[model samples]
Target: MNTSRRTFLKQSSFALAGVSLLSNRLFAAAAASNEITGIQLYSVRDDMKKDPSGTLKQLADMGYKYVEHANYVNGKFYGYAPVDFKKLLDDLGLKMYSGHTVMNKQDWDEAKNDFTDKWKQTVADAAIVGQQYVISPWLDESMRNNMSDFKRYMDVFNKCGELCKKSGMKFGYHNHNFEFSTKLDGVRLYDLILKNTDPDLVAQQLDMGNMYEAGGIAMDVVKQYPGRFELMHVKDEIKSKNPGEMGGGYESTVLGKGVIPVKEVIDYGRNKGGTTQFIIEQESYQDKTPLECAKEDLRIMKGWGY
Candidate 1:
């Protein structure tokens, strides 16, 4: 193992020894506590790609009971078919409750006035795996550039919600910097999305870190939308080594390790922001391995009473 990985294992060794005892109680409390916390698998994307089963075992060892996925292709998650993937997680004492899949305008055929069969399959597979949310994490530039097209696509978001609801799931959208920075008819794209979509049908998975680069504040957003957000991407933003990446000039780091007031915002989400799921994500590991970042993030969140 690399130095960072070795350091992480050494630091967590004592905690890991007691994980089997604390984990069940912690996970049970999280389930009954109205705020379900998890780690987004993207934080350990490379490890997962290399060994999904092993990666999950590591996460379970770190005391994480829930996970959110960033990979799903060809009706499979991390190279396993839905059934097999679910079994893998079950065997490792982990559960994937949410996943990110980008839905674009092309997924909906305007001529047929319906979603493509491929998108439908995505929701179906998600339901089979027991996911509660099927989240679309991006919007196409073409759809956002024009007011009419944008409004039309918002309707599609609602439709997707309806489709997901049939499987006992909700369709959700995750924001990036562009939603706040970009505008349609002089109205911020994020505002337009909230105003147009049905709150009951479609949910928003707010990414606390991405909004920072767009000059949006997490406290301000939760206060404005109140109860519209059902899930949140728990993240913290720090100066990027390579600024100008994706026009955000910032990258995600471990929660509470950056400038964002993560605990305060999450407190609001739990008490009043209508957020039920908080999934931790860290994309820039700095000097640590992704698993190390994930473990630290979880530790900090538990300290904050999540």
Candidate 2:
């Protein structure tokens, strides 16, 4: 064949391939845009007890496409047996992408006799609930008192993270202000936990508002560690009329209206950081119900064009 004809055919094939690739990229972007917003179900812990299935249905109807779980007792999820809740979420058109299950919660229920296999069971139950992450969201007073205590917990965290890895899930730590407020020998316990943990096994679900409450700066943490964070609990805190006598920041109002630089953090997570899921976790339901705050948050996120 002639050289000029051969080159022309090659160019034609390349043009077709580029068009196909651009079409596929547009399709993926459209799919992602279809999901309106997501919420962490801990926002409505009270309503969950009265009516678990009913509450989730309401959330789905309100345009919440994703929900991260915050309840699991024994191998049971919500009050339903393990497998059942997964089916319920599927039926609701909602995905249980993650769960906030720690080593100490209902794992020690005396009648359940499930105390011995605490951490491993936490990972397994997460799978049963269709979760990709099993998040440890708290550290008690003893764990926060010193660096050594935090280090001791890292061993357990590592063990749990390994267990999660085996089950196609990752272990993560969620935070509150206590991690920053109290420190061990001048070192912030939060930083120490990040420094010691194995990155592969442990992921950071850095609660933005809580970190801000702990006296750590928001943009500073994002800039300091580029890719250590995976998930982010998006909350906002209203500074009390008084200072020095503070309450929980996790138990703050919805996003944006409070103090956290949420939109700035969101932009960082997408362009610079490694975070995948940005979950809205509201612990305080004041001046309105939990469901109302969730709707308000969704509105705020839409307003910000996220």
Candidate 3:
């Protein structure tokens, strides 16, 4: 019943967004729609790595019902096996709906025309743990350089989507700044990706903060791809005194406390961006701890009626 209702709500809302793609009515109705909001566990990676139970408990105490994972390797999440980890989450009254696992070109075998066993197993395990989405958070450098290869790899994305579909899950991709700035054959990589992938199979998990590094505007992207996004990384950017990835320029701060029109974006996404999964992620906290940031981000989301 939980999965059914969750899927129905997402699919129905997505259809609404899709219908209002050319209209602004979606934004008008956005705030009234309740959305699934959660935190990306990577925001507390260090805490989790040190004490998975305690870290999860803290998040649960902060009133997070859903979570997305960024740490799953060798059939384990943080350190527990898939089944055990799922139990841990269930015990805390928390659910994990998605995960970030990097799927590179090497994971596919051109000779056999199939994904490597490892990647297949990855998808299978994700289903075992009740993940609705198995998202590859990063694309390797090799997949980005050539137009022909990139397009070919997009086909692989479709195939991965098929593989995931077997487990009643969808394949997803997360973006960083490069997708906006980088171009091939006069086409922005992000645009190409959206154009090429099948929406039913592949979902885009747009990270609003990551695009700031490339000067990409989240509002503009959402408008351009109405009803295309299913998952979103909600973050606000602040000029960072110690920038790392964006050339010492900016990093994430608490929602609404920073420069991004966080509420507006979420509202728009809810109504028109086909976004039902809003996962909070704060990579850089100025004066606050990551856990503190996580708690604050949730508080802000709740205030926004998510």
What value does the lDDT take at residue 302 in candidate 1? 89
On lDDT, the candidate that comes out on top is 3
Candidate topping TM-score: 3
Stretches of candidate 3 off by over 4 Å are 1-34
Root-mean-square deviation per candidate: 14.2, 6.3, 9.1
Task: Give the per-residue Cα lDDT of candidate 2 at 14.
Answer: 100
lDDT of 1 at 34: 63
Clashes, model 1: 0
Say what the RMSD of model 1 is: 14.2
lDDT of 1 by residue, 47-83 (tens): 9999989999999998999999999988899999999
Q: Which stretches of candidate 1 lie over 4 Å from their true place?
A: 1-32
Clashes within 3 Å, all models in order: 0, 0, 0
RMSD (Cα, Å) of candidate 2?
6.3
Greater lDDT among 2 and 3 belongs to 3
Q: Each candidate: what lDDT?
A: 0.89, 0.76, 0.89
